[model samples]
Structures are given as C-alpha cells and as structure tokens.
Target: MTRCRLCGSEAMASVVDLGATPPCESFLAADRLDQPEPAYPLHLRVCTDCWLAQIPPLITPEETFKEYAYFSSFSTSWVEHARTFVADAVERAELGADAFVVEVASNDGYLLKHVVDRDIRCLGIEPSVNVGAAARDAGVPTLTEFLSPETGAAVRAEHGPANLVVANNVYAHIPDVIGFTQGLRALVADDGWVSIEVQHLLTLIEENQYDTIYHEHFQYYTVASAIRALASGGLTLVDVELLPTHGGSIRLWARPAETAGEPSQAVTDVLAREKAAGLQELSGYTEFSARVAKVRRDLLRFLIEAADRGETVVGYGAPGKGNTLLNHCGIRPDLLAYTVDRNPYKHGRYTPGTRIPILAPEQIAADKPDYVLVLPWNLRAELVEQLAFVHEWGGRLVFPIPELSVVEAASSKEVTA
Candidate 1:
C-alpha cells in the first residue's frame, strides 16, 4: 500500500486519477520524434490523517527540476505580480538595507530584482541551471540547487538567518514537504517572516481545474493542510490572504512558533470554512475521481465537435498545466493548430507529448484563427483582453474546463451592455 508522503498515514483516500502521462516539460526534439515517450501513472490521493493531497510516489526532484525549461521572466503578468509582491513584502516586513532576503525556486530573479534595488542582501535557491543562469545574469546571486535541510544549513552558514523568506508557487512542487518546511525553519530568523504562495486546493475542486495535475506538483494544499504541514516544522501561520492569481491562490505568512504575530481574521475564517466544507474529513475526497473523469470526457467531446465543425481552434499559454490538459485529453496539432506563449524560450519549441508547436501571440493576429482556446484558464481575463483583436474578426475565445464556453463579441457586449 502507498503511504501518505506527509503524515505517514496508510489510510489515504483516492482523490483523482489522471491516468498515465509523460512529464509535462518533456517536449521532444525533432530528431527524437520516433522515440517512445516515457509515461507514468498520474494518480492523486489525500491523506485521511493530515488532509494533504498528493500524487503517488514515483518521480524524484532531481528528475523533475534539473534542466527545467520554465522561466518566470517570460510572463508579463507574473513579472508584475512578483514586483508587487517584493514591494509589499519589503514594507510589511520592515526590511532594511541590512536585512537579508531568501527566495526558493527564484526563477530569473523575478522578485529578487525588486529586493536588491533597495540594497538589501538577497540570495536565491534555484534548481534549474538555465533559469538560474538567467538570475545570475540579472545581477542576483543564486545557488543552483534544490532546497533541502542540507542546503538550508549551507545557506544559514553562508548568509546567516534570513529576515524574509519567500517561496512562490513552489511549496506544492516539493515531495518531502515536511523536510522542506523544516529547512525553512532552519534558514529563517527567529523574528523573520516566511511567505508562501500556493494554488488553493478548494479552488481546484470547485473550479474543476484538474489540469494542474502533473508529476512536478506533488501536493495540492488548503489552508488547513498548510497549517498542519507548517506546524509539523514548528512554524506558526500568522496571516493568510486570498490572491486572484492562478485561478485562485493563498498567500500565507508564517514565523517561528516562539514569535507571535496577530493572526489575521482571514486565516481563522478560512480554517473554519474549510472545516465546514469537510476538508478534514475523508469523504470529501471520495468522489473526486469521478468528477475528474467527467471533465476529461466533456472536454474531449467539445474538442471533437469543434474539429468536426471545421473550427480553426488553437491554444493560448504554453504552461505546464496546459501541457497536462492537452496530454490528458489527447489533443494534437490537428485539433489545436498551435499554441501561443509569451515565453520566448518556449515560443520556438513544441509542447511535450502532444507535439503541438508553440508560437508567439503575434501569430494569433497573423493567422486570425476562428477560435482561440484559453489553456491557462486562470489567466483568461488577461489573455482575452490582450487578444481582443481576434473578436474584431468575429473570432471567439473558448475555455474547456468547468464547461466548454464560447466568448463571442456579441456575448461580450451582452455582458457589458
């Protein structure tokens, strides 16, 4: 029996099974077209004891993050988000020129750029060499290695305890959740704050965003699960904020258990809400597998119908979640002519498993496809607004998850009018 990764509980409940799929980033080279792709079972389960939702134990961090293709500087929205976070954190934490800041998985120095501008000492722990190189080039000193207790100790030895530790969209990617958070306890100063941003598990379930499932994202988190995980490492959650990024996300502010801060009402309210929603109960996870299967079927049916109707359907956002959704639904370039990505690195490459070419957003204007499918549905508003010119040509945007919907100019006017 597979034991829970976090709580060591054998009484785990099956949540959703996404079936076998290749790593979301394994976009093959043209020469390797004939090679067979490696696929693994993408089963997800939730621990009954600790309420942590995670994928089956299989891949290692070395296999996932090494040579990572994702660069945080690619997305304009993400860059802006990071800048805003750095600004807000500096003020809230009362960071000064002497203060030290550490960011885990700090790709391309997206947030650290802002921190360093204030002359504060900063260090970045990044696993991917290419992205880490980018961070170094951007004038941020980065250590290209995975964040573990050993690395944390090394960081503490080199830089002393950090006054601020920021981990954005990375807490879920780690497998050794306890050890990683313990490392945070080791690296952060006694009076320091550690802020982590993770996509909310409640939003995933309610919005039917099963596409976020992949080998890299080992865990899905709720406020209750987060509290449990942090408490295991002797940390106390002092604040929580609901963020609109990534469909929906939660930003948690924590510190050492010995130091006290006024816990926000948002934190308490969300915990109580999670309890009322049966997040800590076993039955909450029982029927999730069925819901996921239904989504797969519905999405496939919609895509097939669109293809039959001679729709020139394409995709937006070449993100990891987009890759999982495409691979899960078995979509190919035949169904989606190509995908547009803001990331210049991914622009010239093809999507993994699906083999769909990724292009720049300018290609949308050049081709004027009949339909633009929003893959990163979380950023649908930003994408739709940016690609509004497509609507001028009577082209519509399609979103498959939750349900397939068409956003035509007429419909847009109706909503606004």
Candidate 2:
C-alpha cells in the first residue's frame, strides 16, 4: 500500500488499473521499433483520507517532459481560449504596462503572446528546450527550467513580484504538490491572485474519461483536494468556475490566505455537487474500473468488426488521450491503419507502444478511408468542421470513449456536452 502524495497517509485503494503503458508523448522514429520500449503501471489509486487520485511513482519528470512533443498552438480553439482568458484577466486585475505577469509551464508561449501584444510585461518558465526556443522566437521571454521554490524566489528577485500567475494543466504533472504550490506563492504579489485550470475529478468519473490516465499525470483532484493543496501553500481559494476545456476543467481563483476571506458561492456549490455525487466517498472511485473495462471491450470489438467487414479505417489525431486508448485496447496498425496529425513534430513518427503509423492531415483527403476514427474526441467539434468533406464520400466519424457511437452527418452539436 503506497502512501498518498498530499497527506502521506497509507489509506489508499485502486480506482482503476490500466495496466502497463509507455509514456504517452514518447513517439518513436521508424528505426526505434526494433528496440524495447519502456512502460510503467498506469493504475490510479485514491487516498481515503484526502480523496486525491494519483498514479504511483514509476517515472520522473525529466523522463516524461524533457524533449516533449506537445505544443499548444496546434489547436485553434485552445489559442482563442487563452486570448479570452487574457482579456478577462487583464481587466479583472487592472494590470498596466508596468505590471508583471508570470506563467508556469507555459508551452510555446501560446497564452503569454497575447499578454505581450497588449504591451504588458510577461515571462514564461518552460522546461522543454525545443518549445522554449519556439517561445523565444515568437518574442516572449522564456526561462528554461522546471519550477521549484528556489527558482521562484530567483525569478522574483530578478523580475520582481508578479501581478498574476497562470498555471494550466500543471498541478497533475508534478510529484511535489506542496513544493509546486509554494513556488506559486513565492512568485505572486501579496495582493495578486493565481488563476489555475485543471480537469475536474467529477468530470473524469462521470464521463468515464479513462484515457486521461497516462503516466505523465501523477494526480487527479476534486475541489476538496484542490482546497487542501492551496491551503498547504498559504493560499486561499476564492472562486471556482467549471470550464469545458480539456473535456471538462475548473478554473480556480486564489490569493494569499492571510489576506483572503470567505470563498464564493460557486465554490460552495461545486463542493456540494461533488459531495452529492458521492465523490467524497471511496465507493465513488471503486466503480470507475468497471466502466473503464467496458470501454476497452466495446472499442476493441467495434474496430475488429469494422476491419472484418473490409471497410478501411484510420484515425484523426495523435493526442495523448488517443495514445492511451490505442495502447490500453492493444489496437495495432491492422485495426487502425494509421493516424493523422497537424503537428509536424508527430508526423512520420509512430505512437508509443502501439506503433501506429502517423501521417500528415492531407493523407485523409487523398485516401478518404471509410471510417476516420476521431482519436481526440474532445475536439470533435473543431474536427467535424475541418473534416466535413469526409461526409461527401459517406465516411463517418466515430468516438470510442464515454460510449461508442457512429456520428451522424448533421449531429455535431454534442460538443457542448
């Protein structure tokens, strides 16, 4: 029985056992297939004491993130999401040209670029050299280092305190939750607030999003655990707003605990919703493994049946969620001919473990396979618009997670769900 990362308690139990899998971002060149690929347990367990869900320590941050392939600018909607966030935050915080902003794990400067365009002072801390170089080229100042308490103090000493600190999808990636939160406290101005976006645990279980459980994501948090994490770092939660990004996420507003007071009704409402949904109990997590098993079985059967019928099939995106889904079901190139991606970094590379060939998006237009399995089904809205020409040849788009459904030509409105 491994102890929980947050509270160090020995009371933990399995939520879902996803078996051994490779790091989701570990795409391989053609020559590397002959070499043995490393994989680790993808099981998720929850601390009965804290209700935090996380995978055991099988890999280090350097092993998973350095030389990373995921760049944020690939998605059209996500960039606009950042633009909207910047506009709202700038107005809310009353930031001026002299005020400073900092972003932790800011990939490729996708969000910080918007801040710079407004003539606001901003800096990004990204660990990946390749992505950091891209950010610098785009004219956003970036520091190439993993965020720690020491690094945060150094940044404050040189650049002064930040008016706003932005962290998106970063908390779950690191093992040291307390240290990372402390780093946020060290960087932000005493009166300034931190805005964070993380996938809500309620959404993960309710939607059966098992594909998000790759090795890179060490922890899953509910509103309850989030409050605990922030409080440990001398921060206080002020508000919580649920977002539709990354399938489902929550944007948390926080400030220094000593200067902070009562959390808003939105925060109370979310906590009540989570408790009413039974997320505070061990039984809420125990039932998820069965749901994950059903998805694995149903998706495999659909692909096998389609292949047996002689209908050609391919994939739409090579997202981390797609990598987990493909590997968990043991689907190979035969079941899914090849997957296409817009990012040049992933082109000509094979997905880790499954070895499914990846091609550019143009391949879909030339081949026009009978079925184009949308791998990153969460972005089905944008993809459906971009790939509408597929419907001309009677090609149908399909989503395997949550449930297996062959989407109709006119029913793309489910994206709001």
Candidate 3:
C-alpha cells in the first residue's frame, strides 16, 4: 500500500500523474548533460483519512535541496515580499530586540535581513549548503541541515525557544510532514506562533495551476488538511490569511495546543467554504484531475499550432513550477527556444527534464521572439511590464495556464491606458 506520508493512511487516491521528472531546480551544467538524470514518478495523491494531498515517496531532502541553486534574493518581487513579511510578522507578534525569531528554509536570509535590521535576534535553518552559506555571508546565522524533530530540539537547546517561527512556502516541500510540524512545536515558545505559507490546493485546482506539481513539492495543502496535520503535532491553527503570492497561497498561523484562544473567523470561513465546495468529498479531487488533463491538452495543442505557424516561442521564468509544466506537457527546446531567468546561477544551465537552455533575461530583449511564453503566469502583470520593449517589434505575450491567451499592446503603459 502506498501510504500517506503524514498519517500513514492507506486510503489514498491518485489525483494526477505527471510521469517521471527530474527535480525541478536541478539545472545541469553543460558538462553534466551526458550524466544520466534520475527521473522519479511524480504522482499526486490525496489521503482519504487526513485529507492531506501529497506525492508518492521517492526523493529525500538530502537528494533534493543540498547545495541548492535557487537564491531568494534573485527575484526582486520575492525580495520585496520577504521584506514585507518580516515587517508584518514583527509587528503582529510584538517582537522586540529581546524576542528571537526563527525561520525554516530561510533562503539566503532574504526575509531575516529585515528582522536583523530591527535588532531582533534571528536564526535561519537552511538545509542547502550553498544557500545557507549565502545567508551567513549576508550576516544571518544559518544552520545548514535538513530540519527534522531532532534538529528542532537541538536548535531549541542551543538558542532557546523562538518567539516566532516563520516557514514561507515550505509546508508542502517536506516529505515527512508530521516530523516537520513536530519540529515546529518543539522549537516554538509557549506564546510563540508558527506561521506557514503554502500554495493552497483549492487555489491550485481552481486556477488550473498544474505547473506547481513537481517532485520537490511533496505535498499540496488546504487549510482543513493543514489544521488536522498540525493538530496531530500538538499545534492549533489560530489564524489564516489568503495571500496573492505564488499564484494563490494561504498563510496559516498556529500555536501549541495548550494555548487558549479562539480560532480566527478567517479559519472558520475558509473551512466552511471548502466543505461547501466539496473538498471534504473525493468528487472534488476527481474533478480537479479532469480539469488538469484538459489544461495539458490545451497547452500542447497551442504550442504545436504555434510551431506549425513558424512563430518563435520562448519561456520566461525558470521557476520550479514552470519546469513541472514544461516537463508534464512534454515541451522541449524545439517548442520553447530557451527560457530566461534572473538568477545568474541558473542562467547558463539547462532545465532538468526538458534540457532546455536557460539564459539571462537580457536574451528575451535581444531575441525579441514573436511570442514570449510567460511560465509564471501568476506574475504576468509584472513580467509583461518588465518586457515592455518587446512591443517595439510587435511581439505578443502568451500565458498558457488557467487559459491560453495572446496579449497585444504597444507597451505596458499603453495597455493600461
């Protein structure tokens, strides 16, 4: 039986099978091209017992994230998002110089930089050696190792319990969901809160975000399922917020079960809405699978037709989600000439499964392809603005997911006007 990673429930149903794929961010060096890529089964399953959505167990944290290529500081929007999160968290938790804040999967200290600026004690637990070193270089003390129950206890023993534990977009990446949450409980102080931001499954299905599916993302989360998982670890969901980042995400605030407080109305409202939407029923997942299949067909057809028309197409943003979409859709360099990335580390590399070249964003401006495929469709607005010069050559922007559409305007300013 393929049991659930969280509750060990055998009652699970396959939601979507994305087939064999390499780790999304495993961009390869030119010399390593001939090195065999280990592609694993990328299958999503929803646990009937706990309602946690997860992928079939295949890879470990050590295999996936050590010496990671991604740096949070690479994206301007992400950096701004981190800064905003730090400011808001400090204010909401009433954190001061004496209060300690801990962040898990804190990449390159992008968020903790703001916390340190406030003179508050901050520590980052990053598993990737390269990214952790970058964080330390940025003056943020970071521990380089996977965060498990043992590591959490050790951290607490060394630095004391944290007043706030921030985990942004990491709740779903862990294969051992239970262990990770237990670690949170062990590290947080009595009054401290653990804030987790995950891409909401409900939003993923509704927005046709099948691109977010990959081996690295071991699970998909919804508030109801997350609450249950947290409860199992002696944590309670006290508050929740719907965030616009990463397509659509939910920021959930939790505390130890012993803490006394009423759950936020946001929690009750979203849960009730989810229940009404039949997320509690297996039928919801079935419908989602059907919708995902349709999107795959639509995207492939559009790309094939565009190729036949001799239209030059290129991808923007070498995000993990983009890799999943391309690999699942079986897109290669022939379909997309190359993908552009702002991260210098990834620029000269090749995408994992598709082996498509990744270049600097400057390539998009210089090439000025007839069509620029916006892989991170969630940031379409921001990217379209950034590439406004493409209009000079009468090039159009294409967004495949959610729906296929060609956006044409002289410039971003003209489009808004």
Candidate 4:
C-alpha cells in the first residue's frame, strides 16, 4: 500500500509485519486438504498524514464475505449485546413503529431481529448469500449485496431514508474507507443517526490485541482518525461510547454534517485520551512492534512447554483472530492438537493456514484435554463460565492475548502466568 487508502498519502509507517498468512476465514473442507493454500503478506502500516493504521488490501471483501463463515448468533453474550443495543437505540433515537432501521453487514439477523420484534420497518444489507438466506428465514428483510453507494441509494430510494443505520464491527472491514462511509451516508436520512462500532486502535495497541490484524480488516481507527474518516462522507461524529466487545471497541454516533452540531464531551475526552497516549504522533507506536514480539514469544513458549510436559492443549474457539495468532506463532496441529467451535458450519473444516482441525464444542469435553486454549480471549468472562465444566476433569483454560495466562476452571481463578 504505497498510498493511504483513506488519505492518499505516500508516507505509510510500519506498525508490525506478521509475516504472511492466508485469509483468516478460509476454512478448508477435508477434501481440499491436499490442495495448495495461498498466503499473503500480513503487514500493518499507518499513514503519517491521517494516522489511520491499515494493512494492504491483498484480498477483496467479495472473496471473504461472499460465503462468510462467521455467524454472529453463535455467541450468547454478543446476541444479548445486540438486543440491548437495539433497545437503547430505539429509545435514544425516539424510534417508533413507523420508523425504519437498516443494518449493514447484518450477520444472520442477530441484531435486526430485535428491530423486527418492535414492529418497526427494518432491512439488512448482508453480502454473504448463505447468511443472507438465514436472515430472510428469520423474517428480517435482507438484500444479498455488498454495500456500495449505488446499493445504498437504491435501498434508500425504495424503502425511503432510514431513521437509523447501524453498522457494527464493520467499519474497518472495507478497504475503500471513504466509499464505504459514503454508502453509509447514502442509506441514512439527512437527520437520522448512524451508529458504528469498531475496534479501537488505542485498545488494540495498549492491550496487545495484535491478533485482530488480518487481511479482512483493512484499517484501524482512533477517534481522531475516525472523525476524519466520517467527514470524508459528509457524516459528523456527535458522540462516542467505550464498549467492551471485541476486547475494546468504540461506538461512534454520527449524523449528516448539517445536523451533527457539536460533538459531545465524550468525543472530546476520547480525543484527549488518544493525544495523551501519543497516538497522534509516532511515539505511541515505537514500542508496539517489540511488545507484539513479546506476545508471540510468550505464547509460543507456553504452547511448546506444555507439549514437552506431555500435556494436551486444544483450543476453545476457531475464530478469525485465532487463525492470525496460530499462523503468526507457527502453531500447527502438532502444538494445538485441535480446536473446537460451536458453529456447525466449521465442525468438519480446518483453520485456514494453521490447518488445525475444527471440531464441535462437545469434542473438548469428550476428549478431556489437559488444557484448553481460549483463542477468543476477548470473551474471557463468558467462555470462562462456559468452560467451567473442564474443572470436572481437572483441566484448565489458557488465554494468549494481553499476555498468556492460565486459569483453574474449578474456581475460574487465574492460576499461573
């Protein structure tokens, strides 16, 4: 990426080069194991001009989301989070039964179902054919098309401008940040609200959540850069909220530039926090590569030491972030044994580059592995409780990010470093 995807600047600073890995979601069926798998350079860079951290757009969104593997409804906490967000948004936006709501990248109707329950008019724009079908089956009106300016305008023209456009966890997924933001503006009413939830660059760096860097996520954002990105599409940031989802995320409330008025104190506070952290300058990123290396070293050390001790370590969730960590750490089935996921679509498949076999969640209890590596470590609270049954077999749970830690499942207590 010689030029910044958002700013068009030639000065791109290196953040960290994770070597190369396949598209994180490219799970393989048993039949394709003999075929060659492709990998791409997984380097992250920040544009000096805009301070937006991004990766090279090696793989297109169509390649990854056309038949997406992720199902949002799989996580109970996330589902409830969506339900709560819907309730809050309706109340905050003063939405009524006559109000119209739209969700971009609405996965399996996990969120819009709440909108439907309220008897409000709603639509979902999902790219994946399979998941789009699932949303339709769940009675959520959906368009199986990628969100572009044209698609957004067409939806707005047909259904009339939406009262609210909810884009959760998808702001970083698109390579064309400006165009995607324009699509957002095209879908929303001039005075309607746009709520976006994306992983905060500040949290990703501070918490050592380097595993979230993948080809699919073309860019990362701090509130400062996010304000610039929002303006590029005629939307203005009005408020910001800190969220705990995906390790740490920021929920941005925006509106058409004309109606945006002044940003809330929350926005000013977050911007001050980012500036104080030195993210606006290069100082904040100087030590990040070294810290990321420490994370890689720590995780590899734990996995290798456990293998040498004759302890079996399987994985808890086959999430995309897990693939990045596994591939970056050079972990194969030899080190991880296998991983389990609740999503049935992945049960018989293999993780993209690591080639770690993905099994059903029941297999973890069946095999009684000595240690279970919780790859989706961001869900620490929920997974720790769910896997507490491991205590029955005297097993423990392991978390790799934000430093490697071992927990006794019996009491759900941190036991080791």
Instruction: Look at candidate 2 and tell me the lDDT of residue 353.
Output: 97
Q: Which prediction has the highest lDDT against the true structure?
A: 4
TM-score on alpha carbons, each prediction: 0.95, 0.98, 0.96, 0.99
Model 4, C-alpha of 66: deviation from truth (Å)? 0.5
Candidate 1 segments whose C-alpha is farther than 4 A from its true place: 409-417
Instruction: Order the candidates by TM-score, highest first.
Output: 4, 2, 3, 1
lDDT (CA) for every model shown?
Answer: 0.85, 0.90, 0.86, 0.94
lDDT of 1 by residue, 1-417 (tens): 378877888987778778788888876667667788888888878888888899975778788788887888777788899989988998999998889999999988988988888889999999999899999999999999988888888999989999999989999998889889998888899999999999998878777788888988999999988988988787899999999888889999999999946688999999887787777896666666677778778777767887899878888888888888888888898889999887777767888888898888899889888888888887766666777788878888877666667786334332210
lDDT of 3 by residue, 338-367 (tens): 989888888789999899999988897788
Tens-digit per-residue lDDT, 1-417, candidate 4: 899988799999999999999999999999999999999999999988999999999999999999999999999999999999999999988998789999999989999999999999999999999999999999999999989889899999999999999999999999988889999999999989999999999999999999999989999999999999999999999999999999999999999999989999999999999999989999999899999999899988998999999999999999999999999999998899999999999999999988899999999889999999999999999998899999998999999889989999867698998
Error of 4 at 162 (Å): 0.5
* Order of quality (lDDT): 4, 2, 3, 1
lDDT comparing candidate 4 with the true structure: 0.94
Clashing pairs in 1: none
User: How well is each residue in 322-411 modelled by candidate 2, as lDDT tens digits?
Assistant: 899999999999999999999999999999999999999999989989888898888868878888888778787888868887764345
Global fold similarity of model 1 (TM-score)? 0.95
- After the best TM-score superposition of candidate 1, give how far the Cα of residue 190 lies from its true spot, in angstroms: 0.9
Residue 348, model 2: Cα distance from true site in angstroms: 0.8
Candidate 3 positional error at 193, Å: 1.1
Q: What is the lDDT of residue 159 in candidate 1?
A: 90
Q: How big is the positional error of residue 408 in model 2, measured in Å on the Cα after superposition? A: 3.5
